[model samples]
Target: MPSKRKLVAASAISLAIVAGVAAIYQTFGGESVTSSVAAAAPPAAEVDVAAVISQSITDYQTYSGRIEAINYVQIRPLVSGTIVAVHFRDGATVNKGDLLFTIDPRPYQAEVDRAAAQLASAEARNGYASTDWARAQRLLTDNAIAKRDYDEAQNADREALSAVKAARAALETARINLGYTSVTAPVSGRVSRAELTVGNVVSIGANAPVMTTLVSMSPIYASFDVDEQTYLRFLSHDTKTTVPVRIGLANETGFSRQGVIDSVDNRLDTSSGTIRVRARFDNADGVLVPGLYARVRVGGGAPHQAVLVSDAAIQTDQEKKFVLLVDKENKVQYREVKLGEQHEGLRAISDGLQPGDRIVVNGMQRVRPNDAVKPNLVQMSGDAATTKGSS
Candidate 1:
């Protein structure tokens, strides 16, 4: 009976061992379940991609510039006098020969009258001299008087003629002085506020005070400088074909106004290695003003087939610029690219890229060189149209 009890205890102990082993296996099975879940997950990273564009691109070179008045004039009095009247309101638009100010004309007028009186007296004397000379000639022909007397009368007549000429010159001088008393605009432009008021004394010549200033209203100039290389290229271009330029104001976006290259400086500035260039634009609306900042762009070259990519897709690594391009197998590779002018929203890839290369446009932060990616191809045409419109 004691041996049977011992055998039953041993069987119970064995059953307990089997149960503990099964429980430990169930706990480790959770790890196998996690391994299967990880294996089922996607390996490639998802990224937004766009194809490189191929199109005819017209290149442009941008520059910083300023607006200048085609015609600028400083209005000053031509004669020294008291300002008696102001003909134009302050800051009024003036046309050529428009009266702006009137200096006191009474003094000049009095001088003119004095000259006229002298001229009249001289003319009367000349008439008398002519009669006397004629009488002297007749007397000499008939031998009715001494030769010295005739000679004296001829000499007197010649002296009177000389007096008339001097008087006439004096009269002309007085008339010119009188005309100078009235100040008129020499150009058609918008005038600044008068610097001198009525009752102020104004003077003539270079040391004279400027009464006002004028700047032309229509067809203004936009001046900028181009580098020596660009200047040479411009000179090498066909002379007859005008180069087109565009400009934008400081507050504006893109180059909204158009112009043509009007002139180039005769010599390049050796110190700066640049040449001055001026472009003219229509300003009939009077919106363009002198001394305003302008963003200018000159035509670079003829339109040609070029590869384009979004500026957002470009990546700068150290000193070099690059882009992330995906191959046929959707493996991302780093490509070094040479960039040209940016137009619309797209940048011209002058070198290092070809048409139809897929590039990462968005999600670039999630990508790296040699990364395997699940690329979502997006239509670049729509983006191009939007960019072109803005540009």
Candidate 2:
């Protein structure tokens, strides 16, 4: 027979064992086990989804460029003299033939007077010589004067006439120098500050210092380099028709100005594999400044059908770009894609996508390939939710 206390302790141990087995069975048995697993499994991830947008879009190529002035003039003095007066405010808009600076006119005026006096004296001498020559002709005809005297009178008359012509030429030169005393704007433009102020002496020569700069305010230029493919595709074929272009400043988000292709380089640069291109834009408001950074968009050829998507949906897979495609089963499938230039606010898909395909646009980082997702339909470009289901 067992002891009483030992029997009681054995009974309690048996009850505990029974309870443990029942608990284990409830957790791991048939339907119970299935229910436990079902409770533990996570729900499908929610993500923003939209169908790919397909439209006829112009194929545009973008390039970094610089704003330039169509006509940039460095104002230099044509005559050597002291600058007597500055006629324009710094950075002021000036018209053609507007006086920019005034040099001292006293010296040129004196030269003009001297040349005029010389011309007058030569004319008087020429008058007297003409009279003498007439008299000599009469004398020769009458045989009253020697032939040698008549010949001398004829030579003197010719000399006086030559002197008068020389004086007239000198007078013309003096008048031209006097006109140069007023330095005027050669073209309508915005003028820079005067490099040489009043009382500053300037000289005329090949190495002469520039007095100021003037740049045309309207019809500005934007210059850029284009690759060989772009030049061949859009520029080389057009012989007469103007190609259209657009430009955006550094601070702008979109291309706001419309322009036309102005010119193209004659030859390609073998070293750079590009050709220089220039476009002209109207700057009637004078907002475009030279040397500013510009984003040039060159569009040509014909409109073509393209599929577009938001940039947020793109993913980088090592050396390749990819996106998450949500099929009809709501399963995310990995898709590699080739990209093209951006149009409007969306990126154009050159390959690996088609119209009506649903793509994960947001929350891409939360899901993986083949994972089940709960897609929330939205616009490709906007944040507003839509009632449309995934395609």
Report the lDDT tens digits of candidate 1 across residue range 1-391: 9999999999999999999988887978878878999999868888878888899988788899999999999888888999988888777888999998999999999999999999999999999998999998998889998889888888989999999999999999999999999889888889999899999998777799999999888889999999977777664456713776899899976788998888888888999998899999999888999999999988755789999888878889998999999999899999999999877667899999999898888889997888899988775542431322233
lDDT of candidate 2 over 1-391, digit per residue (tens)? 4699899999999999999998898777878777888999999999989899999999998999999998999999888999999999999999999999998999999999999999999999999999999999999988999999999999999999999999999999999999999999999999999899998999999878799999998999999999999898999976513677999998887899999888898999999999999999999999998999999999888899999998888889899999999999999999999999888778899999989999998888999999999999887873333456534
Weakest 10 consecutive residues of candidate 1 by summed lDDT: 382-391
lDDT of 1: 0.87
In model 1, the runs with Cα more than 4 Å from the true position are 1-51, 236-241, 300-302, 324-334, 358-360, 363-391
Q: Scored by CA lDDT, what does every candidate get?
A: 0.87, 0.92
- True-vs-predicted CA distance for residue 303, candidate 1, Å: 3.8
